[model samples]
Target: MQNNKSAARQYVCKRRSDKMKITVRVKPNAKKDHIEAEREGEYIAQIKAAPAEGKANNALIKLLAAHFDIARSRIKIISGFSSRNKIIEIIYTRKQ
Candidate 1:
């Protein structure tokens, strides 16, 4: 049992790298906020806020943080800040 736990930790460390990037197509002013995974490293986000004053972008980050089960500070919008298509980078540290 001890060996199995060690192996599982190693497997998780290998699978979850320190950082990853994902592309998202955001639909602002939606009825509700939700995220959909279209494919590997791709997603669709529906936000309840309008695309103004960075409201939609903030909502997207919040939604993604919850979906990925990471802190909001770990997610960054790397590109397409003012457009529907966005590239986000997530950085996280695995707990032992």
Candidate 2:
């Protein structure tokens, strides 16, 4: 058994240093709506609201904020507001 502790530590450290931006695919107005986490996972979310009048987009922001335990103001819709796919930018400072 060789020790690879240092290598593992570095990888974990780098991940923490990076602020994660997740891309989600929205499926609106399905039968009994739900959210599913992908295996290659990037915050895949589903909503019951239709993609109209910015309703689904608003719902997405609220759901993500609640799930991540962050303020709604922190998550912004960077792009794809009208499309099914969206990019969300989550900003946070490094933990002390």
Highest lDDT, which number?
A: 1
Best by TM-score: 1
lDDT of each: 0.81, 0.67
TM-score for each prediction? 0.82, 0.70
Per-residue CA lDDT of candidate 2, range 1-96, in tens? 122223221111112343556667788886644555553324457787888999999888888877777888878887788988777776566567
Q: Which pairs clash in model 2?
A: none
Any runs in candidate 1 off by more than 4 Å, and if so which? Answer: 1-16
Instruction: Report, for all candidates in order, the number of backbone clashes.
Output: 0, 0
Kindly provide the TM-score of model 2 when superposed on the true structure, using C-alpha atoms.
0.70
- In model 2, where is the ten-residue run with the lowest total lDDT? 6-15
Q: List the residue pairs that clash in candidate 1.
A: none
